[model samples]
Target: MSPPPAESGYSLVWSDDFSGAAGSLPNQSKWNIVSSGPNSGNQEVQHYTQSNSNSSLSGSGMLHITPQHNNGQWTSARLECKSSFQCPAGHRLLLQAELRSGTFPANQQSGIWPAFWALGNDIRNGNNVSWPQCGEWDIFENAHGADFSLGTLHYGRGGTDHLSKGSARQTFQVESFHTWAVKVNRSPSNWQDETLEWWLDGNKFFQVKGSDVGDGELWGRVAHKGFFPILNVAVGSNFPGGGQPDDKTTTGLGSGLQVKYVAAYKSN
Candidate 1:
């Protein structure tokens, strides 16, 4: 297990320990289960489900987001934080989670894509925002059982034309528990002067400044305000080879993402 991150000069603002009874659902007041299967603009094969079978709490203080294959179809869960939990500018926002993948057959974890990410809250507040223009922060993403995770930021003029800068593959075992995190320090008066950093197991691996992001106008309007957290395990998306799951190779059992806990903090 990775050591907990240093807490110097920071105070915890919110957190989910997932300490409910086994088979129970996530805390409704904090998270909303996304129940749509819309292409997700990624041509993913999984149908996001709100049922406890896909997203549930284990008696042992953890959240299990399992993906199952039924009758040649896939079902998973995507949980988004409530609007009230947005992280605003001027304050340092930090999100940390202990994550690990479930067991899998030998070399059969090819299509599994589990991600812990954040989307700008402006898009959801009826601000007439769109992808890329709204900005996206990928805290951690593991594609096709790859031994390394990718931390990236997507923002630009529009959906068709966007820019991205990512970390250089931080390696880790998929089945082993590891701490993943992203921290953003924003200027109170000027959001463009903000700095973003990514960490794996308490070590900083990537970072970028708001000024480095594409356009100043778009960055301030879309990214400066704040963002909402999202957790999901997608099966067979464009990032993982853009192919459907092979029934012969994919096993539903032990093919999920496990979260020990998730928390947010404000830096002093």
Candidate 2:
């Protein structure tokens, strides 16, 4: 079935419309399945897979990506479009998505990490020598905290050298769905100044003043290039602290992340 007519006053620039192809991916034209854990900095223990079994649209506008426990390890699906479908650079853009925690949820602190975000459009070709410098926009990231999620920006240097522009906590009722958004723009000097915000059931909750893109030069320079979107659910990582340090692999509810759909709009 086709998507409902685009909402009045809002043009549908891009959408996954989960109303079609339940149990199957929409199309390569919309999303490129990412199959690896190398770019996943969270130290998550799940191998990203690209198959209908791992990611599919279920009827009623819901997409399910259950991380499965197989071969003595955990594996799930991750999707990206680094070079394939780069978002127009230097334009104010919004990355939004409706996501739900899996059926057999994994909230083991050290387990169940799901996120909706974007990266520099040139990351696939090795253009991003340093993150955040290359640019990253995390719209919504949940760490299994009773009903709270996190929004953050990591750039300049990786790990300890990394500088976070801002971060916030919001209580999330995962049993239901919510809309998460990240608005980004750059200054004349090419520094990427961004704003992070979100809501549960259309109720405002999380917001933070994003990092200043052009304020400093200690870590080279920052640009206002827009990045493509990334949707994934990982096992565990040092970033979303709360998990057991000893548990290095993904366990608990095998099924990983579930996404209803994703969209983006240019801020006029």
Which predicted model would earn the best TM-score? 1
Model 1, residue 19: displacement in angstroms? 1.0
Quantify all predictions' global Cα lDDT against the true fold: 0.77, 0.57
Q: Could you tell me the lDDT of residue 156 within candidate 2?
A: 65
Model 1 clash pairs are: none
TM-scores, each model vs. reference: 0.89, 0.75
Error in Å for residue 209 of model 2? 5.2
Instruction: Supply every candidate's count of residue pairs whose N, Cα or C atoms clash at under 3 angstroms.
Output: 0, 11
lDDT by residue for model 1 (1-268), tens: 2223457767877778788889999998999999987466686788999999999987788889988888877899999988423446667778888888756753676677888988877678898888887778898887666677889988776758887888887888766888898887775577557778899888999988767764677666434567788889888777734455665446553678888888888877
lDDT, model 1: 0.77
For candidate 2, what is the lDDT? 0.57
lDDT score at residue 164, model 2, on the 0-100 scale: 59
